[model samples]
Target: MKDLTYRLPQRRELTTALPGPKSRELSARREAAVTAAVSPGLPGWVVDADGGVLLDADGNSFIDFASGIAVTSVGASNAKVAEAVAEAASHFTHTSFMVSPYESYVAVAEKLNEITPGDHAKKSVLLNSGAEAVENAVKIARSYTGKNAVLVFDNSYHGRTNLTMAMTAKNKPYKTGFGPLASEVYRAPMSYPLRDGLSGAEAAARSIRAIEQQVGAENLACLVIEPIQGEGGFIEPAAGFLPALSQWCTENNVVFVADEIQAGLCRTGSWFACDQEGVVPDLVTTAKGIAGGMPLSAVTGRSEIMDAPVVGGLGGTYGGNPVACAAAIAAISEMEEHDLAARALEIEAIIREVFEPLNGQDTVAEIRGRGAMVALELVDAEGHPNAALTAKVAAECKAQGILLLTCGMDGNVIRLLPPLVISEELLRDGLNVLVKSINANS
Candidate 1:
């Protein structure tokens, strides 16, 4: 694999307007051919991507502030990642790690064990997506404790599967009309300090009280939570809430599972966001940013908990494809070599500096996040969330050659997840575009 130096390729425009004629033609065709639910976030269609720029089918160059929804931590079209992927593709594609094991698969698992938090004897199992890892974590927990109930927090997004849909909190896009969800899934309130106006301890106490009174701690198998809620608007738990919950879970038999699918892999300036709290969870599920954009997920946990499941219970045909595993190995090496954790902190600093003036503005309700996983919530003078303003700002940013995304239950927050490997100049350029867009829209 080639070495990935800090390089920013020059940006050029070959077309006068975005979606120039060709992209618009193709997009129209796609609108007619593809399902309505399959929607692209950005307005234009992408034909090619390299460095920090995405070339739309119309020949426009747009800076990618959204790194494939935080999946491509190493930047798009990274030479090292591409070369590693090509080499693995040439050797073999799929051997099914379960039926026939391979070195790359085991190597990825070993790397996950070493990198994820907790000093206890750790084990890992690979899967295809974050939801699968989360589902398997619950399965392992149930098998280990012989309990039927699983606990999750409000505004959390686990996955799209039936069980995960039940675990998720939002309804419009994820759960609407998808009734009769998996049973034994319980929901609890999370620590949203900004809106709830509760300290971490207070929020934790409320959640615990609800769980103890309703779910019965003795029947619970696991308490799954995102160290920092991703799809829910980058809300970080109150400082003491996670530690207190960890202690409670320890006292009780419930396993503490950290769903770091979006916040892990140095995206939040740490290998695992849970590490920030100094509390070790029983299991950690990681996927996004794990393989430099490859489709790979893992469930790492204490050996005893992982081993509780019987043989033949936890294997998937395409769980650990060789190419994805190889990419994982390369991605992990790149993260360490570049000190992306520190770079994430640098990205956070830039965002804070850019959005500092907006803090006192009436339209800007809150600016919160850790490391590069940052967000800005929009509101009216009365502090009511303004999803329309958030949408308008994002659309303006996209038009100005910057791609951004909005999240949260109300769609009132603009979330930024630039690749950890992005250059300081490019990162600031994107943020400048965002600032200009916000100012113009506001």
Candidate 2:
């Protein structure tokens, strides 16, 4: 293994208020120039980031637990990723893969094909974002099965695009005012064990019944799901839920697509969350952690399904940018060399060690998730969503110089997506602050 070092000190430091004077000035400028729709989580005005620390313009250092929405699994300023990006940029940046092919793009596809589940013959198509990868996965499924209906789950968050918005379950911020979404998308019951109190098989049966009664199997093109949901409270389905769905998709000829955009690439103690249950899908959509902060995504699947799309029917001008591909290659190497998957397991153990006892608290409904992607579901004494307390806890953490993120349909789940390369001391400090904040808010 190669020796790696963090560029900045791993401690959280506060020299000014939450949104310091510099951040406040930037926020004012942003309000005037940028639209109100583009709201940032914390007005920190980051100037540099390394390891688990984010240095803002106001000279405050924050412990990063969000990982930039799970995009920088290898750390924000990973040396190998930076070196590769600079090297690739010096050579040539853009020569659209469609117009003039590049070796790095093909190399990335090959790497993805080899790492993704299943030993069968497979292929991959690179894209610019997770939404595009999912959209293309659906397109490939439709082309292969000649069906138009897509099946998603309740409480699922796919993307913000027209088709994905139609597939998503949340209606408030993502779907509101963006009506007239794409047609032929259906939602089914998900295996939420905490809320439903049903076994894995029982939940699968319920979903199967819904599919059969509402949208018949013959009419469905694909069944898309996030193995460990990111925005939907990091919900991990019951143990046997995924396997049963995979079998059903096989029997009905419907493409099984695992939306591993946020949960894949070592974020969940494995290359992909689907691997935890040995559930191999026909298609897998990947992004976020793929390139260590670079914009890149891909859909890897069985050769026949991926090949179903016509030659010119797929691809974009910046689908497989060379620099992004290089960054992906180096970031993948960093993960492999450093064994970040195992590191993720260590992070999980640290988090659970600190948070497991909170399960008995009246305001804590559940503590669930796998690997580095953990969530704390906040609820009132009557078991109702306590979004108010959740927001307060996050605000308090931010004031203390710890960057936290909240999610869930009701905005009552606090998600922790620390970079896989984060040190144990830094992660524990962040968690300690979070626990104190939760206790204070409660």
Candidate 3:
């Protein structure tokens, strides 16, 4: 297969209005053909993307702060990842791992086992998406422990699959009308330091108390948590919170699963966010940044637990696609070679330098997150969520050829998921646009 020849200039430029004529035409076609429920964070159609810039159909270049929702940490079109994918494709696309397993799948598994937290013997099951990994993790936990209760936190977004949708906390978009949802999933409170005003220990105690009273360890299968909650806002739990929960799980024989689908893979200035606290979970679900934008996810865990599932029970037809495996190997290598974890720290410094000062202002309630995965929460005069202002500011950024993404249950968060490989100049430029957009809108 021939590749598209496009070299992106490392800057943001817009010659036409927000969406050019071609993009408008394409949007019209998309409207007719695509499902109505499929929503886009950014309206324009991107023709080419490299590093941190997205080249849209209208000749407008955007500084991409949203790295395909944190999928392209190595960058939108990483040289090493692309080359690996191409080489793998040249060999053969798929002989299905469940049918005729290849070496790439095993290689990727070995790497995940090595890089992820804990030096203990670990095994991994590769899959197509984060949700699939989550489901499989739950299944493994249930199978090993012979329990059914699965606990999650508020503001968590697991996925759209039936089981994941039920695990998710949001009601309007993700869970509404999607009922007949899966059973045995429960929601617990999270450590929202801004809203709850509780210390990490206090938050942990509250959550644990509730779990003890409501679900209890005897019947609970697993507790799935994000080291840094993503869709619910990049709320980093209090310092002692994770350790406390982990200890409780250990004492109770309940599986502690870290759902690092959004915060893992050096995106949070560490190989895994759980490493920040030195908290090792029994099972970890990972995806977004794993394959440099290729659809790949893995449920990596202790060998004893992963081996609990029956031989035929765990395999899937598309579970460990060779091409995606190749991309993952290259992506992980790029992260290691470039020290993207340190780069993420640098990016955090730059972002905090700018947003930290605005905290006292009425419009900017708080800044949360670490590394390239950061966010700003907007508030109104009464300190309530200002979703309108958030929309206005994000729209202004889009108009100026800067791609941004908004999240949070209230729809009042402006998040930055810039690729770790983004140049300092382009990142700063995007931040400048963000500051200008905020100031203008505020």
Candidate 4:
């Protein structure tokens, strides 16, 4: 394996059409063997990657803007991440964290404790995915608080697992037929300033009132929230909402959990999005971007709450795999050394400078977000959401070689989660492409 500080390569390259012949062949074989419902929307195959460029199997190279749904914070094919993964793979790979403890696993947990918010003594338990961490968090909260119900926000996206699906508020794509989900999950209103006419305090009050009335504070085990709702449209709760909710949780003995899976690891210009509001949650769940693309998730929280679950209740056979833990350690170190949080702020600045002017335009409704975790919602002159326009803009950006993703409950928001390590020049170029796409669509 190479040294951890090695750098990445330059921009994209393309010699053949996207999903070149080789990729097409492989994709066809996959379609034949696997369910077509799980296929990805964009180019489906990647042969190799270096720096920000992904070389597809068909001899096409493309700049990766999605970052694997905000997982690869350092950039795809980061040299340090690659070296770390290679080194870990060369060592003993699997020893279930429960069966035999390993240094990397514990080291990763320690890193999470130090990096996550609050000076309180924190303990971490590793998991394989964000949903697992969230699920375990509920289990711990219930065990500790002796409560039956959990409170989740509307339009929130936790994960695809059954319990998480029940916790998730979306319907068509994620929860369509997953009937009779886990019981005792209650829904609450999320404070979306863009659509909901309320300030942070007002929104928080309204949501808390609903929770208190519907579930009764004593019956609530935990209140789980996404500091910046990922699939719910990159929505940042009203400024005071989080702090207010945290205080309420404290007084009511409800575990305040922040699901920072998509908003952590400096993607939101902060170590965790909860930091934006100066809110310290009892439990913080993180996964995306933690291992620079490796599958690793964790639930870090107050030591006592974490200890609520009895011994044997909190692990998986593959939880805390050594390689993923090693990758997490290296990825987090890289984030710190490179000051990715500051870079996320820089990215946000660039985005605001480019999109702020569009705010008052008939085709643009609102430009909102914190740090690089930014989004813009499209609306018509009458203030109706223009999902069609957003879709057109995204397609145009893709055709012009700039990748983008659309999100939000109405599908009218454009979210940007570029790698924090992307060069300023390339970043600006991509933004320019986005502006052009929006203008053309308008």
Report the number of the highest-TM-score candidate: 2
What would the per-residue lDDT of candidate 3 be over residues 1-442, giving only the tens digit for each residue?
Answer: 1112235788889888767899889889988999979877665788889988888888888889989999999888888899999999999999989888899999999998998899999999999999999999999999999999999998998998999999988887888987899998888899999999999999999999999888989989999999998888888888899999999999998999999999999999999999999999999999999999999999999999999988888978888899999999999998998889988999999888866557687899888898989999999989999999999999988988888888899999999999888887888888988887788777
Which portions of model 4 show Cα errors greater than 4 Å? 1-9, 12-14
Residue range 198-266, candidate 1, lDDT tens digits: 988999999999999999999999999999999998898888999999999999999999999999999
- Give a tens-digit lDDT track for model 4, residues 1-442: 0112314344555566665778788889988999976967666377666545556666666666788889888877777777888998898889787888889998999999998999999999999999999999999899999998999998899988889999999887888887879889999999988789799899999999999899999899999999899888888877798999999999999999999999998998889998987889999999989998889999999999999998888999998999899889888988999888988898888888877657677888778888778888898768898999999888877665666788988899998888787776667778887887777777
Q: Ten consecutive residues with minimal summed lDDT in candidate 3?
A: 1-10
Q: Which candidate order results from sorting by TM-score in descending order?
A: 2, 3, 1, 4
Q: Which one wins by TM-score: 1 or 2?
A: 2
**Pairwise lDDT winner, candidates 1 and 3:** 3
Which pairs of residues clash in candidate 1, taking residues 3 or more apart in a chain or in different chains? none
The C-alpha RMSD of each candidate to the native structure, in angstroms, is 2.1, 1.3, 3.0, 2.6
Rank order (by lDDT, best first):
2, 3, 1, 4
- Candidate 1's TM-score reads 0.97
Candidate 2 lDDT tens digits, 1-442: 1225998888899998768899999999999999999899875999999998899999999999999999999999999999999999999999999999999999999999999999989999999999999999999999999999999998998898899999889888999998899999999999998899988999999999999999999999999999988898899999999999999999999999999999999999999999999999999999999999999999999999999988899999999899999999999999999999988998999999999668799999899998999999999989899999999999889988999899999999999999998888888889999998888778
Q: Where in model 1 is the C-alpha error above 4 Å?
A: 1-14
Worst 10 residues of 1 by lDDT: 1-10
TM agreement with the true structure for every prediction: 0.97, 0.99, 0.97, 0.96
Model 1 superposed RMSD (Cα): 2.1
